[model samples]
Target: MAGEPAVTPVPTDDELVVVPLRHWWRWVGGAVILVLLGLLGWALADAKIDYAAVPGFFTHDIMLRGLVNTVVLAVVAQAGAIVLGVVIALMRRSANPVARWFAAGYVWLFRGLPVLLQILLWFNLALVFEDISFFGIWEEKTNVLVTAFVAALLGLGLNESAYMAEIVRAGLNSVDHGQVEAAKAIGMTPATALRRVVLPQAMRVIIPPTGNNFINMLKGTSMASVIGFLELIHAANNIASRNLQIMETLLAAAAWYMVVVSVASVGQHYLERYYGKGVAR
Candidate 1:
């Protein structure tokens, strides 16, 4: 027994104590109650209530256009946010103290402010400047759509960049200092080392959270409606008010939103899985 491994006898299956379902009857009874409640709801809402006006309302030009606008706004805003977020993330991690400070401050201020207030402030920014000229292109007017869309994009993108900076920074920091040192040991510059060694590894952490943020930004695009951007919710509100089928129209908007978010969720899940392969490091 001096160096021998200890051996233990395996127990029989019968020795295991398995708890039976004492609440089986409770579950059955609850299921029955739920079925009855559903039946009652169907009889009242689906059977008797009329939804004849819904198709007519939904098919209207305004609602269709509004839905289109919502899609466009979400896409554009997300694109801007992603690009700006990466830029901010890079700047925050820069070697210069001034660059780091300015990037950090931008993220802090925007993240701290309410998005609605940010949108409103942007819509009114034209009042202060009169006109914004970019590369000799002067904005002809400070119109509601232009102002509101710009404001919403800036507000959401800037706010999102702050949060993204933290995510990106975390991803970048997740990389081992040894990798950077190793790269330099092989004659790589800091920038080249980051590009070839650090960023690829950091992406495992960076991508999943950024996808979630993009989904959130898609939903947040609705805030643009406040400044007269005729997005889905705004259109639904208008349709419901004029026709008095408020519940139905609101429900329709909710349905569309649910569909969009659900699809985004599926995509996010797959992306997470794809990016997660490197996480064991």
Candidate 2:
């Protein structure tokens, strides 16, 4: 009995069976979501609205002009913002106390104020100052110089610069301090190092948020309507008022906004991918 081998019971195929887990709740949740979407779609379809008018107004000459104005304003304002943002960002990082304080105050003031108020103030700048003078060489009436478009641009651009300054500063900060040191070690000037060594690396971090900001700026151009800049929303409002078809006109404008935003989003995706290359995901 002491020398006998111990018997080991081997598991049969049936004993090793695996029962797959059932996610019944997931199925139920998905069905519920589908049902809700269907209900919403049906309600929208049954609503009494002039669907035909949307198409006609979608491509109206006024709408097209407004679209152009919106695109132009957004592009130009963003360009100005990027330039100002870089300068302010550099100022924020400057060793000079005055530059740092000025940059901080600029960010705080603009970011604190409501952008609409800024726009209105710019539009009505004539109330505060009659004319703008340049070193006793050139002068112009405030009202003459600050047209509706100029007011909108300044308001949007300057306000955006406050945000972009922070963004650029963050991007600049993302670069390793050693990179700047290395550039200096190679006898590069501060400006040259920033342009040649630092900015290239910072761009990888900067491009994504900058793209989002541009899209936001595009939509934000709607706010310019209050100052009579004749952007997409204002153009739509005019048409709506004349025809007494408010919803249809507004919907058409919304469609155009969607189209533009979609195109911009695609572009942004490619730009991001381009810059994101060489970085591990």
- Alpha-carbon RMSD to native, per candidate: 5.7, 2.2
Could you tell me which 10 consecutive residues in candidate 1 have the lowest summed lDDT?
Answer: 137-146
Please give me the total number of clashing residue pairs in predicted model 2: 0
Give the candidate number with the greatest lDDT: 2
lDDT of 1 by residue, 61-108 (tens): 877887777777777777776677677888888889999998889888
Clashing pairs in 2: none
Candidate 2, residue 51: how far the Cα is off, in Å = 1.0
Candidate No. with top TM-score: 2
Residue pairs clashing in model 1 are none
lDDT per residue (tens digit) for residues 1-281 in model 2: 89999988998998897889999999999999999999999998998779988999999999999999999999999999999999999999999999999999999998899888999999999999999999989999999999989999999999999999999999999999999999999999998999998888898889989999999999999999999999999999999889989888989999989998999899999987887786947
Position 230, candidate 2: lDDT: 91
Residue 210 CA displacement from its true place in model 2, Å: 1.1
